[model samples]
Target chain A: MSQTHVVPTRVYYTIFAILMFCTYLTVQVAFLDLGALNTVAALAIAVFKAVLVVLFFMHVKYSTRLTWVVVIGGAFWLGILLALTMTDYLSRAWGTFG
Target chain B: MLPDAVEHHHPALAHQFDSLAQQREAAALGMWVFLVTEVLFFGGLFATYAVYRWWYPDAFAAASHELDILLGGTNTAVLITSSLTMALAVHSAQLGRRRLLLLFLIATMALGCVFLGIKGVEYYHKFVEHHVPGPGFEFEAAYARQAQIFFSLYFIMTGLHAVHMIIGIGIMLAMFWMSWRGRITADYYNPIEVSGLYWHFVDIVWIFLFPLLYLIGRHA
Candidate 1:
C-alpha cells in the first residue's frame, strides 16, 4: 500500500489565519473609494484566498498531474464561457448592425 | 507466492482492479470529473450575473448596499474555518487518528451549521426589508427594476450555495457514523478524502461568492 502524505496541523492553522486576514482585508477595502480599483482589489484578494484553499485544503498541490489537468481544465472552460459571452455583451454598445 | 497472492486481495480492492492504488486513483479521478461538472454548473450562474452587472452597474451597486457585509464577512470566516477543519479531518483519517478525525468532522459540521444559521438570518433580513424579487420587492424608485434583477441573482446564487452546504453537512454526518463504527481506517479512507474534496469545493464557491455579491457594490 502506498503511504498517503499527512499534512501537518500547523499548516492548516497557518492557512486559516491567512484566509481570515484576507477576508478582513477584502471587507475593509470595499468600504474605501478606489474608483474602478475597488472591484479589482476585491477580486484579486478573492483569487488569492481561493488559491490557498485549493492548494492546501483540497490538496491539489500534492495531487497527481492528471488531477492538476482536471483542475486547470475546469477553470479554463469557465474562462471561455465568460470571455465569449462578455464579448457579445460589451460589443452591443459599439453600434447596431446595419 | 501464495501469501503474496493473498496480500493482493484486499477486500476494498475490486476484482477488476489489479491493486489498491489503482482503485484509489480511479475514485479520485471520478470525483474530480464530477467536480469539474459542478464548476460549470455554477459557472453559468456566474456568467449571467456578470452580464447583468456589466449592463446595469449603477443599479447593481445601489442594490448591493442593502446586503449586510458584517454578516456576510462573518460567514466567510466561518466557512473558511470549516474548510480548515474539514482538511484536518482528512489528514487525521490518513494518519489513522480516529478520534481526531471524528472530532474534526464534527467541528466542520458545527461550523457549517453556523454558516447556514447566519445565512438564514440574512435571508430573514432580506424578507423583512422586502428584498424578495417578486411583486413585494422594494428598492429605491429609480433603481427598482434593475435592483430587482440584482437581488434575483443574489438569491439564486447564494441560495444554491446554501443548498450545497446542507448536502455537505449530511455527507459529513454519514462519514461521522462510518468512522465511529470503524468503517473508515487508514487503509480505506477514500470516502473521507473524497468527501473532503466536496466540502472544500463548496467552500471555494463561497470564497468567490462573498466578494462578488457582498463586497463589489458596497461603495455605491
Candidate 2:
C-alpha cells in the first residue's frame, strides 16, 4: 500500500491564522474610502484566502496531475462564464435596458 | 481451504481497483469533479450579481450597508476555523487516530451549526427590516427597485450557500457515524478526506461570499 502524504497539524493552524488575519483585513479595508480600489482590495484578499483554502485545506497542492486538471479546468470555465457574460453586459448601450 | 480464501481483501476496497491508492485516487477525482460542477452552479449566480451590481452601484452599495459586517466577519472566521478542523479531522483519520478524528469532526460540525445560526439571525434581521425583496419590500424611494434586486441576489446566493453548509454538516455526521463504527482506518480513510474537500469547498464559497455581499460596497 502506498502511503498518503499526511499534512501536519501545525500547517492547519498556520493556515487558519492566515485566514483569520485576511478576514480581519478585508473587513477593515472595506470601511476605508479607496474608491474603485475598495472592490479590488476586497476581492483580492478574498481570492488570496480562497487559494490558501484550496491549496492547503483542500489538498489540491499535493493532488495528482489529473486532479490539478479538473481543478484548473473548473476555474477556467468559471472565468469564461464571468468574462464572456460581463463583456456583453458592459458593452451594451445603457438605453437598451430602458 | 480454497485458493481465493488465502488472500485477504480490504473491506473498503472494491474488486475493480488494483490497490488502495488507486481506489483513493478514483474517489478523490470523482469528488473533485462534483465540486467543479458546484463551482459553476454558484458561478452563474455570481455572474448575475456582478452585472446587476455594476448597473446599479449606488443602490447595491446602499443595500449592502444593511448587512452587519460584525456578524458577517465573525461568520467568515467561524467557517474558516471549521475548515481547519475538517482538515485536521482528515489528518487524524490518516493517522488512524479514531478518537481525535471524531473530536475534530464534531468540532467542524459545531462550527458549521454556529455559522448557520448566525446566518439565521442575519436573515431574521432582513425580514424585520422589510428587506425580503418582494411586494412588501421597502428601501429609500429612489433606490428601492434596484435595491430589491440587490437583496434578491443576496438572498439567492447566500441562501444557496447556506443550503450547501447544511448538506456539509450532514456529510460530516455520516463521517462521524462511520468513524464511530471503526469503518474508517488509516488504511482506508477516503471517506473522511473526500468529505473534507466538500466542507472546505463550502468554506471557500463563503470566503468569496462574505466580501462580495458584505464588504465590496461598504466604503460607498
Candidate 3:
C-alpha cells in the first residue's frame, strides 16, 4: 500500500524564512549598480525564490514523477515561447522604437 | 456489496476511482494540467514585455522607476506570507486538523486582501501621476509614448494577475465553506490541496512580476 508523504511544520517554517530573506535580498540588490547585470540579478533571485516555492510550498518535491513531468513540461514550453519570440526580435534591425 | 461494506468504502471516493489515493492523484494531476495552461497564458505577456523592454530599454527603465518599490516589495512579502499560510493550510488538511485548516485559510485570504489593498493604493498613485496609459497619460516628453506602452503592459499583466487573485479568494471561500461543513478529511482533502496549488501558482506569478516591473530600473 502506498502512503502519502506529510511534510513537517518545521520545514514549512524554514522555507518561509528563506523566502522572506530572499525577498529582502532581491529588494536590497536592486539599489546597487549592476549595469546589465541588474536585470540578471533580479531575475536570478526571482527564479530562486520561485523554485523554492514550487518545491516546498507547492509540494512538488514530495510529488510523484508524473507531477514532475507536468511541472517541467510547462516550464519547457514557456521557454519555447519566450526563446523563439526573443530570437526573432533580437536578430531583427528595426528603424524606430514602438 | 459485502466486500465493499467490509472495506469501509469512503463516500468521497468517486465510483470511477478504486481508492482515495487514486482520486487524490487524479485531482492533483488535473490541477497541474490546468496550471500549465495558465503558465502559457501569462508567458505570452511576459514575452511581450521582454520584446518591448528590449526595444525601449531607456523608456522601460524610466517608467519602471516610477513604480513605488516599497509598496511593491511589501506586497511581495505579503503574498509570500499568504503562500506560507496556504501551504500550512494544506498541511493541516493533510493532518486532518480542521481548526488549523480553517484558521490558515482565513489568514491566507486576509493576506491576499491586504496585498490587493496595497496594489490599489499603488494604482491610485499611478493614476494621480497621469500614468495610466491613456490620452490623459503623461510622462517625460522624451519617451512618453514608449512609457505608455510600459504602463499598458503593467496594467494588463498585473490586472490579469489581480483577477486571478480574486478568483483564488473566491476558491478559498468555497474551501472554507467545505471545511466548515466537515467535508474535508485526512483521506479526502483533495480540494484543499488543489486550491493550495492554485494559490501558490499565483504567488509564483507575482514572484516574477515584482522584480520585472518594480526592480528592473532601481539601479538605473
Highest lDDT against the true fold, candidate: 3
What DockQ, on C-alphas, does every prediction get?
0.77, 0.82, 0.74
Q: By summed lDDT, which 10 consecutive residues of candidate 3 chain B come out lowest?
A: B4-13
Whichever of 1 and 2 has more lDDT, that candidate is: 2
- Name model 3 segments beyond 4 Å from true: A94-98, B4-6
Q: Which candidate has the highest DockQ of all?
A: 2
- By DockQ rank, best first, the candidates go 2, 1, 3
Q: TM-scores of all models? A: 0.96, 0.96, 0.97
- Over A1-98, each residue of candidate 3 has an lDDT whose tens digit, in order, gives 22678999999999999999999999899999988888899999999999999999988998889999999999999999999999999979755556
| Model 2 CA lDDT for position B136 | 90
Residues B150-211, candidate 2: write the lDDT tens digits: 99999999999999999999999999999999999999999999999999999999999998
DockQ, cand. 1: 0.77
List ranges where model 1 is wrong by over 4 Å. Answer: A96-98
Give residue A46's error in model 3 in angstroms: 0.8
For every model in order, the TM-score on chain A comes to: 0.94, 0.93, 0.91
